[model samples]
Target: MERGEKIVKRIDTAKEAKQNPSYFEALVELLFQLADDDFIISFRGSEWLGLAPHIEEDVALSSITQNTMGHASLYYHLLEDLDIGNADKLAHERQAVERRNASYFERKNGEGSYLQEPYYDWALTVVRQFLFETMKKVKLETIINSSYQPLADIANKVLMEQPYHLAHWRMWLKQLLGSTEEAQNKVQFQLEAAWPACADIIGLGPKAFELEKHHLIAGEDYLRKQWLKELEQSLSLPSSLFVDNHPARGRYGEHTADLDQALSTLSEVYNSDQKAVW
Candidate 1:
């Protein structure tokens, strides 16, 4: 299936979970994975605001941030249904240690501050987001077929808005890879940086089998295979064999200081106004 077309066909689903206990647990884990991935990455993306290489690129990238933020919000709302907490509080008030996001998403955007000493790397940003979103699209595609109705339903809705995100990143990848020698080299460097922990993003955590057995979603191994296949066919671009490995697993809640730092930043506002409407 074509990359864009794959996303388009993933838009029909029911928004309710199956009334089985195992299924509910699987649904919860799936939601956490989805929420954490987007929440952490979107935070990183937000840090890039006004720091992109070009003005047009800034506007273009912001759309992705908004989309990821929207995805996070959707998961937060689902958590609310389980009486977890208000969506904003869940997003903004949690401590770093309590966060369930992967470490990679929480990494700093290149180096220096976005406001001053801004030494951002466009290659890293583009490659990381592109690769991450590509895997995310794969996972969401499987979720649309989940037995848990609510998850499948939300997945369907999310799939509708994912094409632009995929297209935007694909364009960046193509242009940079096809650009000047320096640009191609930089992209290659970023891809290498992203390769090691890329597997963490696809992890199904501690409850992988249970989640699958309950029909909450597809199995981890299956999803991983699908993700790789999708990546292979994502764009008619490069064809070099890439190495993928995971030194630290994020699925079981194993994380790094990066996530700790990110949770603190994201929760600052919500933590302060936990009692307020905003």
Candidate 2:
């Protein structure tokens, strides 16, 4: 699996992947990215369980959030098979510095708790979900031909349900942008705030070169171009909205206070009884 060499063989199991150190390392890193991204964003989605803009939206988002969390679990299970750690501990016990999710996904919904005066922002939710699902769709499609057969299988399974998820968010974004001036302004503001923080989301982390060299996934440039092309054609969003200038690089393990808060909240129940069989 050297640079520029075609991946002639498919790794059918984690044991086969572990035979090659380079391939195994890159595969683990890529898995963490996939798992962490979905895990954190799904938690954010759950924060809106009963607080969505309307009753219909509340139900829709809850369903979508559950699906996303299940997707995360699938990826984490793959890691567990690789002997990295238990999927539960990997998801719940890892610290912010150990997380590989993009910092943007970990940002608070708004300036309040979900149980108390939950002043969540629907516009921000719309923008973030649209962007994230679009990226997820592109990434999963690209990895459908992954050198790791197990990962490719999971990608195919995920794609079966992911399109509906993307459509759900796209509909929200379109309706928001098409509504009155106030709605349009809120969406625009969120886009501006999100643009600068999304660079890490599209990245494959510090082992990116290895991931590409091993044919575990496509190059970052290809993924970014495809993502941008999809957003531009579908949403008519400006290319400038895709700029990469964020200071925190979650792919490199750099995160924010938002992630610290999110980790605490998400892990509370698991931490309560580490040996509990859920």
lDDT string for model 1 (101-120, tens) is: 66667677766766569787
TM-score of each: 0.85, 0.95
Among residues 3 or more apart in sequence or in different chains, the pairs in candidate 2 whose N, CA or C atoms overlap within 3 Å are: none
For 1-278, candidate 2 gives per-residue lDDT tens digits of 68995645789988899999999999999999999999999999999987888899889999999999999999999999999999998999888999999988988999889878889888988889988999999999989989999999999999999999999988888888889999999999998888887678798888999998878888999998899888885565555644667978999899999999999998788888989853
For model 2, the local distance difference test gives 0.89
